[model samples]
Target: MNRWLARLLDTRVPALPLALFRIGFSVVMIIEIEQMYRFRRLLFDPMPYVIESTIPSGPLLLIWLAAVLFLLAGYRTRLAAVVHYVMAVIVLGFGALPHGEDWQGDSLILTLSLLLLFMPSDRVLSVERLMERRRRAREKVKDPGPVDVRLIHTVFLYLTIGLMYLDSAFFKLSSPMYLSGLGVWAPSTLPINAYHNVSWLMSQEWLVRPLGYALLAFESLFLFLYPVRRLRLPLLAVGALFHLGVMFVFPIPVISLLVLALYLGLVPAGAYERFTRLWRARAVSLTVYYDRLCPLCRQTVAVLDALDLRGAVAWKPLQDHAAEEPQLAAIPEEELLHDIYAVDRQGRIHKGVDTYAAVLRTSGWLAPLGWLLGVWPVHPVAQRIYGAVAEKRAREGGCRDGVCSLARPGAPAAEPAPHRGPGRLARPAAGVLLTAWLLSFVLIVPAGPLLRTYVTGDGALANRLENTAEYYKSRVYPWTGWTSHGVFMDEHFVNYRVQTMLVFEREGREPLRLPTIRPDGYTGSYNSGRLWELWTFETVKPELPLDQVERNMSRFVTYWAVRNGIPLEEGRILILQRPMDVTLDRFRRDRLADNLSQPWKEVGAITGSPGQLKVSFTGEPGNQSGLYGPRS
Candidate 1:
């Protein structure tokens, strides 16, 4: 047992896993940043996100992303980590990002980014490594590569997955729906889940309830399985399934995909090397067929080629191969047009995510990742996910309608251009920083109070961490509560849409539901952010007393009237809370199901007097209006 423990803790790992994970994390960060920016740069979107600082959120976010880019290139690793952690803590604490549901979705990413600092993430396939290599080559010295640490960073990463599951399981257990084994179907049924096609399965209570129980057990089981070496692969494999299921049927792709990516880390060091040595996949050649017409497809191909260290994957555009490849003609054009496929030297064919899985199989350090995904239940689910994404494939490119320069070289790519110069710390300095962090984190993360704060979002350690982290933010702009990553999808598998409408006492000017942006004839606008943003503050802001909800409503309505040029000396503003069953089958094209004004409750009211308005809000025990009346 001691020998096994030693092996488990001290196994020498290649730099590839960390590098690949870093690159993937960076890409996700950039995508998330771009998506948020496109949506007016609020942390989340269209609602209930956190970010309204004295400093405009856009510049602040750009600065945050610069740190991410630095992290991506593995430069100034310590500084980037500190910067990210500080921002994350500020957002989590003061930004009111939580808004009283559970937590925001990106919180997982923020937490992982914090833990990432302690790992040897920059040692391989990074700009830092590349610089060291070049420097070594110039000086006629052997490149020794990265050093393995005393504690297993990979194990710590594994435990985080367990922690996430444990916390989620705790919440699930607390919910009657989950305890009754209906929770699995409930989240999938939510209109907000975005997995519309498969939502039909909600009726299969047999399938869903059991799946719910299975998920609960699955999540809870891994905690015990952490120390069992023999079951590690199976544990990770099962985890892949649980997360893949969530990925397919939920809108929480950021966390689901992040977890899936990290699952690759659970494979023991040299597992892929052993697999490759056992099977001469090095001798294997792969021809990847992609719809070059799709920009996403082309970009995916470029990334795959860049990561394929074995010179094994051959990229062919389906448009170019239609005539030459007999296999292309054999498949239906409709099927071939949308989904990407791969043909191996053995004449075996793989499609969609399976094709990508095969490419990863040949790609150094990621072969086991391919193996895990290609394994039975997980593979099937992955295919479904791939199909789902494929269903929404955009044919457009950088130049629009695939009419752009995508020059492809005939040979395998060599030593990709290092996305250089994020930071310039030498290996020794970086290692020292990493070691110090790991030592501290190993002690801190598992401490009773720290764990409590992390899981519950409030505790002594949480308060201290929150306060200490504030010191790290840019002093010029106070981030006390302006930036945060709330818990991931604390929406409780329910959709809450808050609507405010003005009812004028005057003639012919009927009440109008507040449009998110400027209305056609309106000179005044109330929406600087999403509806949930306004609602989040009104319903949950602690400083705003319960009696002031009506006043808050009055403020918003008054502002809206002024902006829209509506003559409103005395118009009542009603803050309506529309709570919909996320798990119910509301068959409508709009995410709101085109059902508005129905099933609405007046959570808060603003009475417009001749001179000024008085605002008030009420909440019942079961409701989450963020306003709780005096306890009975």
Candidate 2:
């Protein structure tokens, strides 16, 4: 029992997966932050429905941006992780309250950032690692060749992911739409959610029904099987393809990207190494020779080494190899010391700024940078800058004494020592903390469902269980709300589509529609989809009173009018429901040409000025307005 516990808690795996995860996570976050910044006004501005002020200040977003950038560079990684996580909770969690833009993807990002705070992601593939390596080289510390992370770190990450899948699968299994094999098809009809029209493909029962079942099976089995070492790689591959499909088909790019980032954590260290080795083998190779005795040159080379992720560039000291290497024999030692040189596979030497470009070209991601530097207009300027820097370094660098000693290659001084992890007491404490965390996670994730399922009758025990379930639902579920993975998992999703239309009745002009319906779709540019989400929540749920919905719609229209410089002294905000049954019936009968010819039914309408609008409901649950045809 002790042996098994030790293996589970103390065994170390390669740190590459965590490092890669940090990179992907940071990149996705930066993209998400950019989008938030773009829509800051709409997201942070006050709204009629939001009773309390949840506005996140503009400077907070800038701070969040800085934190993510620092996290990406791996400088003070733990501190950056903390800052980013806090900022996400404030800016993404609370700030999105007014616009109702907060999503499960945001929660997932928060969870990942929180996990990153405890991870040693800076141990490799970071600016911190480069600095540490250089410091160790200077101090003559024995090199610890590669970094390793505790197995428990990875275990928790995978555990969280598996629980997410399991939670979603359980909900999907209980959903009648999924059972009927119309889970994917139902959501495809929602214009607000879809990016491209795939109704024809989704309507094909033979293709979509099996796909629905396969998706359900995949999610259901993932929790149990993904942790198996032999099955992990295959599952990860399928997961990637699945996310890619989601990204292409849906407008929720942020969600798909975050999920894909999480997939990086499941990659095995050995597999990552093997794939990188294969990539490096196929890449072009170059050898860079620099002045070793010159501190500036050595520092520059160290930075390049950090950037050389593909391992395509080999660095050698010109002082040590000038005499032995035939390629360098032709160039004078004075010229070699004056500027850096790179020899390509064809034995052609590139000098000064050109050498930098050649070396950069061998790097996978930096190749575009190399091409840019070598372009017609930029090349001359780069050459001039390189020449001036090289001249200054050659004159006053550390080599001025002409007798500076250099450490031999492969010596202790040339490599960094392995990182010493937590102390003896701390390690055991970490183990205990991790165990407790896993236990709590396992217990809390399904607490609501379990409580609701077993506890029954109106006794004290049942009341307690009901309270516990409600507590979990209102509090804990927000953080772990991956249960709604089956998009449009209800019958109403197939029955009708929700749309909000804005009309501006100007004094001297005809009424203008805020989003003019085009042949392609709704063409409003400013946060139109977010508004659709908001209106859908209001109309479908019917929890909010008609007056509150009207007030909110009035405020939204006024905000849009102000932004677009439109005079909206009087107008009507119409929340319409378009029946989908007729279209689905047509689609089923192979009459695809006029599938979208169904007329809209007004569910509710708010008329008058923004301040004194009157609200009324027509096609509500009890009221009949042809919303569901003869069934109503």
Candidate 3:
């Protein structure tokens, strides 16, 4: 047992998987932030209450963006992680409360950021690692070999993710909707979830039923299969496919990509290394020849060598290896000295800008940049830029008489060195924290159900446990309930589409419905799905209190008018419910078009100007005064 514990706790593992996870996580976050920034006025500014006290939303977003960028670059990573986490909590967590903008994906992001605090994710493939390598070289320190992180950190990450899926699966299994195989089909039918018109596909019982069961199985068994060494890679591949499908089918791109990013942490060290090795073996080979005696040439080569992680480029100094290489011997010595050259495996020579582009193409993650530089319009501009730089270097007499002060191209200074692993206390601390976290998953998270089953006496102990469980469920794990309860497991699926219309009550003209909320086509439907949800579900729903809905509608109308340049002085906002009975029978009969052509029913309306808007419900008899209030 002691040996097993030691192996689990102290063993060193490759940090590549964690590094990849960090990069992927950062990329998804960058995209999410950009999206939020694009819609900041709608998302942050129009909230009924103040979002932040000290920092305004705009500046806060900018600061959060800078922190995320630093985290992405892996510079001052620990500090960046902390700053980003605090900013996320402030902006996304609490700030969303007033506007009912809290998303379950934000919870996952918060959890991941917390996990990042404990991870040594910057140990490899980071700017910090590169800087440390340079520092060691400058100080003449010996290389400490390949970078590796503690096995405990990797275990912590995997267990946290596993428990999340397992927790979700536990609740899903209990849900009648999932057991009846209506889990996937129900959500696909809703306009709020589906990106495209997938009602026809959802109507196919043969396809959806199996997909529903498969999703349940994947979520339920992922925790078990992911830990098995041999099954890890295949499980991750399956997960990738699952998330990719979700991305195409739904508008929840942020959540889908975030979940996919987490899968990177599950990749085994050996498997990742093997995959990279295979990629490098199959990649096109190229040899780059540069002037070693020239300071500028050597500097440029050093940077490229660092980026060439797969060693696809053979960097040979023309001053030293030209005589030995037949390919170099074919080219004029004067031409070789004047400009950089790349000889591919086919023995075709590329010069100047093309040579740089060729080198970039061989480097992993830099291939897109290489393609951009070599493409039409860009290639010509790049050639001119390269020529100007090359001309200046030649005029200055690069390395006069074979004398240069810079280190050689492939010197010890340029080679990567292993970074320091986590501190001695880090392992024990992480182990304790992770153990407690897993215990919360098993004990605290489901405490309510467990206590209710076993402790039926209703004593003091039972009461305390019940209170604690309720607190955890309501406060600590509020966002998690959405994941646990099968998504779209509502008692009744929506049979009507909620449409918000901006009506202008002009004297000479009929009530004009502005195109603000009306989606144009499939793309518009996909983009404005969130807007519909905000106005329909959160703002103007009949279930909401009349006063609250009125306030929300006022803000909504004001923002809508300002954003779309619509005059709201003599206008009223209408919340119409359009019948959309997308049943399996209708789908089979090819009568889905009948549902779309149905006339709109005005369920609610907000009349008068922006600030003085009065909300009134015209739906069912009792809905006029709202469900929570007495009828007037």
- Using TM-score, give the best candidate's number: 2
> Model 2, 500-602: lDDT tens per residue?
4455554666766655233444323432334444545543323345444555566666556666765444545565544334232122422222234555555
Best by lDDT: 3
> Can you write out model 1's per-residue Cα lDDT over 504-613, one digit (the tens) per residue?
34545666665432232111123322233444444333334545444344544554565466655545566554444443322223333333324556665566442366
Ranking by lDDT: 3, 2, 1
Please give each candidate's TM-score.
0.52, 0.82, 0.79
Instruction: Work out how many backbone clashes candidate 1 has.
Output: 18
What is the per-residue lDDT of model 3 for residues 315-434, given as tens digits with 9 covering 90 to 100?
A: 887777878767777777778877888889998888999998888887867999999999999999999988877765532233653333333334434444444455677656766665
Clashing pairs in 3: none
- C-alpha root-mean-square deviation, each candidate: 15.4, 5.2, 5.5
User: Using TM-score as the measure, what is the rank order of every candidate, best first?
Assistant: 2, 3, 1
Native-vs-model 1 lDDT?
0.55
Instruction: Indicate whether candidate 2 or candidate 3 has the larger TM-score.
Output: 2
Alpha-carbon deviation at 464 in model 1, angstroms: 20
Preferred candidate (lDDT higher): 1 or 2:
2
Task: Tell me the spans in candidate 1 whose CA falls farther than 4 Å from its real position.
Answer: 1-9, 31-52, 93-110, 144-151, 187-198, 226-230, 269-308, 312-632
